[model samples]
Target chain A: MEKLLDIKNLHAKVGDKEILKGLNLSVNPGEVHVIMGPNGAGKSTLANVIFSHPEYQKTKGSIVFKGQDITNKKTNEIAKLGIFMSFQQPEEIAGISVFNFIKTAKNKLSGAPVDFFELKDEIAENMNALSMQENMQNRDLNVGFSGGEKKKNEILQMLELKPTLAILDETDSGLDVDAIKTVSNGINMFLNSDRALIIITHSTKILEKLDNYFVHVLVDGKIVHTGDKSLADEIDKHGYSTFKGK
Target chain B: MAKTQLEELNRNIYDFKNPDDYSFKAKGGLSREIVEDISRRKNEPKWMLDIRLKALETYNKLSLPTWGPDLSELNMDEISTYVQPKTEMKDKWEDVPSEIKNTFDKLGIPEAEKQYLAGVGAQYDSEVVYHSIKADLLKKGVIYTDMESAVREYPDLVREYFTKCVPLFEHKFIALHYAVWSGGSFVYVPSGVELDQPLQSYFRLNSPESGQFEHTLIIVDKGAKLHFIEGCSAPKYNKVNLHAGCVELFVKEGAYLRYSTIENWSKNMLNLNTKKAIIEKNGKVDWVSGSFGSKISMLYPMSILKGENAKTEYTGISFAGANQNLDTGFKVVHAAKNTSSVVNSRSISKNGGIATYRALVKILPEATNSKCSVSCDGLMLDSLSKSDTIPVNDVQTSDAEFSHEAKVGKISEKAIFYLMSRGLSEDDAKAMIVRGFASPVSKELPLEYAVEMNRLINLELEGAIG
Candidate 1:
């Protein structure tokens, strides 16, 4: 498998308090990596730091993506380099339609003109797959949407952008059974030989639908254990108490 | 992040000037002679001339406002109250002078009239050069023409509602407007007649160191409905200019009238304009305003709900960029039983610009069961900008309900980062947030005007990244 992302000794902080302390990980193409950690394990912070979120200051070390040093890049630049993140709690931007936002993002990242008709058809198809109403495209992005609907919208964006790497941060936290199935199916469709995923979750319910994955147990901002799918089952049954204080 | 340049963001698209091309120009100053000369040149009646003289007296007697934005920069002695373009009011577009017509053409007035307007009026400097209404509307007894002609033709009707909504003695700028007001529109929607399309008026002030004081008076009779749109723009100049126009609207019983305005004055302008509406029993008035230009602006469109069950709604937005101070809001007075009013206002300030929203909502003692709700939100793009919300709510009646909400803050970094993570540049992200912030007022405008408002916001946010 081709190496897609490499993180070495990454130490990050938010407002003088270090959250990600010398964390290191690697992601390969065509692989689904599940990151399971207890509370205050810096799960969301790691996702944000990878995207160079302004709030997360990288105090030390480096993050290399697709053989490029993107540690100091702006979020938009990193995004244009084929990186997408599904936020745990997305911000509701009023008066901007979901369809328009996705279209603009796709156009900006690709640096190409998009056919309006084709884009509409593709959006409608993806929305239908997610069981989202047609009017959802015209409504303000994430404004007044239910928790499940917001999560589905995030997956919809991920599918539309077709990024090389995606970081899903707690995407299944607030979803119901049907919504989880729909979201998992959408994620599965996005899985191919050239793409990679980093799934951050507390529960293994969504992982049951995904395959060919590696599970890493992260405790206190560092990955303590790494194994195959059985590791996820182990953590599901025994919890992260074994990884604590390691 | 690279700091955005304030100069690049404050660029003006309407900054071309036509050489001093006027058939008549009054000497720069405000005096009895200048006001009398304007009235005499228009060949007004004795009563109209007397009113102008009285207005001049009032203008001299009243002092400048003490509470709002400063007006120490306004020098009446340096501003020419009137500058008559060469062309007279022509009902046909082809007859208008090319130079003056091109100005309106660049502003998309002719094209807009052909596509969406039932009537169009174009004012240049101190006089309305072009005015026309659709034949169907004319056949239905709807009157839409220049105010000068309205005074000549329908004196009784003009005198009945003129300044009744916004009296001449209300303020110093209003008094000045009444004294030197030269060009504007006079619209009358007959009883039971409803216009399918809006009638638009475009005002262009081309001369430097001059003022554009146009008066707009509209009346919607019983069971009638009408939507009127007003647009203003001026070229930039080194010297200061003034725009103290006045608008008065009267909606009769069971009538509806919507008044929309987009004011884009130059940076050298001191715009102190006034607008008011009087709604009768079961009548409704809606005000949609977007203020985007001018060095200093003090505008508060008022609504007087005087009849039972009357209604008024105001939706407005203001964008104050570098070197601009805009104090804008709305006022409503519930005088009769069961009257109601709703106000939603938004403001954005950047690059040391100051935007203040000052509102007043009053429920009188006899206004039983009256309700009023006011919401004002302000957004500052950077630390250098300033925004304030000052609201006064007085509920004299025990049975009335009044609610007010005000908020002021800078752009959220988390929101910007989220947008940036979606592949939008930092500038684009900030622009989108500001556009969304002002969308409530823009959505209330016509489709084309809403697009123009968004474009204006983008231009104002060109380099507004923090």
Candidate 2:
């Protein structure tokens, strides 16, 4: 039984244009797969479809996570089923306290009352993990958070949910060097053999630890090339214009 | 099949109900007999009973509401004049039976009471079956109790404040409520009493298809402060349920009062409720309300500033999802020098729901150097849903300053694209935008309630867009 996510000919479109064209890939339990391509290349689309976003119409495709077909699952349901997606920009949920939002999210994933004392302790701990202020958990969900703070908050949610398959959508973008290292450690903390990670980012700076893993290059809505860890280094040195699937 | 052109709210609980249990009810009508029957049921003094008879005459002369949802369908003959839950008001929490206890329990009244509430009361059906207050508040001379007991025990106190501010002749609904009003809370803050915590009461209409005409009156005396929160709900009914209740608040000289309410009535209700507050010199009133349920509702809390340096702030949000027409807003009348009122409101209409915000601001000739500002924003998730804002500004004095601004718009497609470009699914992006649209109003609510408010917003927003 494959422990990783299997995407088979996943095709999706938004409005009139098709973004993800027949993309295909698979990741092992412990592998960290990075999808990189040009600006319009469907890197983020792949991340969204994997997390069962209601938009991004899935025309023809199948996404199997841990041997379960979740092609048409609700986002919250998909999240509870051990699939997590860290949005590139975390949403600012006004009026919703950070503690209450995370508590409900954790409950949805675990289907139980979050140990109040333990959850508070863990939230205090995870705030330090993301280099966040001690009172961040008490504040409204990203209401007045800065750009880098929003990304860190996304990573903070992912850490608490701790899904078996984590898909991070450019969460490292718009971060300073110090903040980038903090988010990078957060990814490492959630990395394990029993779980797989699908990180979609243009820069591989945060991918320093999990260097040698599967890399897929998406161009024109399709995974045109699949390679080892060095593929990311090649793409960084030479942009997507130098690569061709044929 | 085209979705049923769903209204903005599934407040069908305000619509229709099956009346299998009305207990002993009077045929809805304004007559001496009906009023006498009610007075007989409540066991009122002759003088008080005489007030009911006079109230009936006042009700007959008053005209029905000409604006908002049509109440012509509200047949007086069909409404059960009085329907009491078969229990008495219990001070000891456990003495309250399980069934009635379960209703308040579902509404999260006790939990909120323990957290930061100085007083709490739970009203089931047409009567208050349970009421309590923190001992420290009572010791501080803060009086919080059911209105029925207040009228009975403190007749002088009740006489001093009752109906004087919002008399029965104020309007038709007030007259109707005064005639048949059964259960609600009365909060009185004596001079110099500054309550630190909120006082709460949960109202539940459990008997199927019964009319609930409860009245809540709170008076903050001179140099005092208080915060009162009200919660209301009802079980679903197949017939048009009615809640023509009233609430009047009096914030006296240099006093302040904050009232918060979250009403989640079932979808079959015609929630034609009324509330008003009058502030004297140097007084302040803050209103925080969330109207998320009701089939057809026309509710607007009004504030009247009548003394120098008086101020008021009203923040409200209404969500109309399916089969609901919630026409709700607020009105502030400035009648004194340097009085101010600030109103911030938002409405979300989706799934064919209809949401409206209609308000009136009238500054009297003597209201010199007064200021008032109103900002209303509406977001319609789909083309079929509708949002409207009708505000009237009547400034009698040239020294009064007032501004009314509103915008009705649909969710931006570009914003959705921007969020999706940043990796959020279209649905998530839409939810985030809608959530943020309501942030101004929800942010004013307390902690746990804000989450519940967001959840209700999400529920109403799910199929609002493609």
Query: Largest DockQ belongs to which candidate?
Result: 1
Model 1, TM vs. native = 0.96
lDDT, residue B366, candidate 2: 93
Candidate 2 residues B178-198, lDDT tens each?
888888998889999998888
| Candidate 1 residue-wise lDDT, B1-466, digit = tens | 0112221333445777889889999989999999989999999988788878888999999999989888998889999999999988998888999998888888889999999999999999999999999999999999999999999999999999888899889999999999999899999999999999999999999999999999999999999999999999999999999999999999999999999999998889999999999999999999999998899999999999999999999999999999999999999999999999999999999999999999889999999999999999999999999999988888898999988999999998888999999899999888878878888988899988887887788878877764
Q: Which ten residues in a row have the lowest lDDT in candidate 1 chain B?
A: B1-10
Look at candidate 2 and tell me the lDDT of residue B216: 90
Q: Provide the global lDDT of candidate 1 against the true structure.
A: 0.91
Q: Which tens-of-lDDT digit does each residue in A207-235 have in candidate 1? A: 77776699988888889889999988888
DockQ of candidate model 1: 0.56
Highest TM-score among the candidates is held by which one? 1
Task: Write model 2 residue lDDT over A16-66, tens digit each, in one string.
Answer: 788988888887888888888888788888887776565679999898877
Q: Best candidate per lDDT, number? A: 1
